[model samples]
Target: MRELERYYRVLELEPGASLDEVNQAYKDLAFVWHPDRMPQDNQRLKDKAVSKLQQINEARDKLRSHKARLHVPSTRAASQSASNPTSQQTTTSKTTSRQAYSSQSRTPQEPSYQPPKPHPDLTGKDYSGANLTNRDFSGRNMSYANLKGANLSDTFMHKVNLFGADLSEANLFRANLLLADLREANLQSANLIGADLSGADLRGADLRGARVMIGDRVQVKLIGALLNGAIMPDGSIHE
Candidate 1:
């Protein structure tokens, strides 16, 4: 059965497309959906770009592998031919039986490999106290997400929209949160050791009692971030 239709659809081509066609189609779509072309502030477009690029890559690979496999000789057919040279000259009555055997030995129909489903949509979702260590949540819209007491250590959250999200008591050790919009976020008692918050928007964010220091030295990075009305790691607040 032809299970390659999905690949063709991804490439915007009809079934029975040549291998060359698939390669060209992937290039065309990737160029159009690439995230670099989108505006820096457009988080929605960037997320879409990441998901689209992944699908295009998978489609091209599946089609190319299938084509390559078709060219390889069947080991079972070759072995049968070598073992039954005398039987190859079968009578007319036995010719039908050989044809049936050859058909049975044909290459099996293998399903194409599809990548696992993408991460769940976290838009305004409640995930308080979730252990989400080392996860990649870059370029996502997690506005108002309830992340209180969540372990987000080493997570990638670049350019994410976490406006009004509750990140109280979250562990963000060594996390990459560059250029994230954390306006009005609650970071009370969160462990931000070695976390990068460069170019982030911390306007009105509450960071009181946050673990942002290591032996009197600040372990958090906040270069180019907006801190209007934000509470500092200490008891004082930023005017």
Candidate 2:
């Protein structure tokens, strides 16, 4: 498995290295294997790297604890550390101390860390009334999809494919939709106030009753879009 090979490469010792050597090797290998330093798109590789790091940590723990010193000590140590009451107590105490120190040394945890979901490949699929506010759907293929009444406020959809999509009554307030393909899309009554539509294709698209402004000055200036029946920024209705 890739996991086994990664662990072996990280330790740099033969397949039967002592736990002490593995720990020392981990200290050296961590510099290059740290997940934060790795490329973002290589998440699976970084996860494997982290798993190997954990194995090194387990190897060191087994050696120090004087438990069974098998060739693959990490696997056995983890099981023992989990099942043994003394080891569990020691682990709990250390964790509690670390937590107390961390509380003082670090800032409080942020409320929640729900990462933005990746855009679904829903090209030509009907997604009417979908609540996708403040989501990043940039540069995705969503052409010919029915997105009527969708809440897409403040969404980042730059250079996305939206040709012939039904975006009628959709909330696109302050959205960054620059260079997007929206030809023949039904944008009638769509709330596009403050949305950036620079270089976007809107030929034959319905702009009837669409709100295209925010305040006295246009928050999002439409560079090359239709203005038929759309509300202008200066409160003057576009004919």
Candidate 3:
């Protein structure tokens, strides 16, 4: 058995779990195995608590990615349908019918399957200049994380908390950053072309010299958000 196996047992779940089951399991186990719940008298127990927390976080990430992959095909189809809106609907209907039949043929009371875990120490790590294109970071708490100069083209960051994060010079072209909190974040010289910033809290964020397209829809909350030196989609500068 692996070291993380102990953590899986603590959560009373197998290592290979589906995303839905991973979310539910994390909620249940966090209530019991939280560091606050453990006594601080023994150093060994405290260490164990830390290890368990890392394991749980890793498991959740793995499951989330696995679940996200399952929806990719459907997403691509939907994107195509949005462009055509005619022939794709017929194909979609047939596919949906086949999927319904497949689901019914499967076991009625199906248990959730577990997926692989992620690296334990990914949070707050420096990921400068990394290629993170088309990645999903939805609902993740990445406060104070350093993503400077990272390539995040076409990524999805919906509702992610990025307070005080460093994202300077990052490439966020065509990214969906809807409802993300970028308070006090450093986004100097970052690319926001075609990025959806609707409902984003950009309070105290540095947008000086940032490349922002005018065609992209951005609902700015703060008054002092710098519009100078921003490149609009109309091929004009947002002065």
Candidate 4:
């Protein structure tokens, strides 16, 4: 019981908090204590953040496991109650009627996917290893930001300023970077698979070992963009 309470306290939640609340608290705390949010020069703070994140993750996992174990007993009781011959017949009848009614009713269609609204200017922010998939960050000034190892899959960053940003090892899978300013950005070993870089300025950017091609065919667009002094995927320096 004391251990359980400790986990809840780690997540900043009260005892007996609902699973939804626990999950939400975990997400919020993870974002707050993520190492990328701290200054790279500050090793002390960054180490603390890393330690906090690990604790948060552990707390969340333990709480979830406890919740699952608690749920199993209730489910077993429900099953035992339903196993009685009289109760089984009644349940079957009710289930058949409900299924018939549901068949007659029109099924609701799932909502279409909507792009995320624009956020305030995120210039120079640290979002390393963050899951920002399918978001629209078009025209945002994120210059010199630390986005190393961030998940930017399917993100629309058209015309965004990422000048000199540390994007090494970041996942840019299918991201839209049309006309964006990526001058001198560190993209070493980054995943640029299926990314749209049409007309984007990547002058002097480090692309060594970055995946910009698939099987000898260039999969990314560099139409009319500057690559002066940038390193190519093959470890060759671009002229």
Measured by TM-score, the strongest candidate is 1
Task: Give the better candidate number (1 or 3) by TM-score.
Answer: 1
Model 3 lDDT-worst window of ten: 219-228
Q: If scored against the real structure, what TM-score would every candidate get?
A: 0.55, 0.45, 0.43, 0.50
Decide which is better by lDDT, 1 or 4.
1
Ten contiguous residues minimizing lDDT sum, candidate 4: 106-115
Model 1: clashing residue pairs? none
For candidate 3, the per-residue lDDT at 71 reads 48
What lDDT score is found at residue 40 in candidate 4?
56
Error of 1 at 109 (Å): 8.6
* lDDT tens digits by residue: candidate 3, 1-239: 37445545545678755556667687555434545334546678768877877777776665566556654422344445345444546877767765665565455344344445762434576878999986667677887889999998877776677887888899988776667788777888888776666567776666665776455555322222334443333435555
* Model 3 score (lDDT): 0.65
The better-scoring model by TM-score among 1 and 2 is 1
lDDT of 3 at 222: 22
In model 3, residue pairs whose N, Cα or C atoms come closer than 3 Å (at least 3 residues apart or on different chains), thus clashing, are: 16-114, 17-113, 17-114, 17-115, 18-113, 214-232, 214-233
Model 4 clash pairs are: none
Q: RMSD in angstroms, candidate 3?
A: 19.1
Cα-based lDDT for every prediction:
0.82, 0.67, 0.65, 0.81
Rate residue 216 of model 3 by lDDT.
Answer: 56
Q: Note the clash tally of each candidate.
A: 0, 0, 7, 0
lDDT of 1 by residue, 1-239 (tens): 26688888988989878977887787667656756545568899989999999989988999888877766556676457545646556576466656766666665563334544876668789888898986768888999999999999877788889999999999999887878999999999999998888789999999999998889788887877899999887867798
* Selected candidate, larger lDDT, 2 vs 3: 2
The per-residue C-alpha lDDT of model 2 at residue 162 equals 92
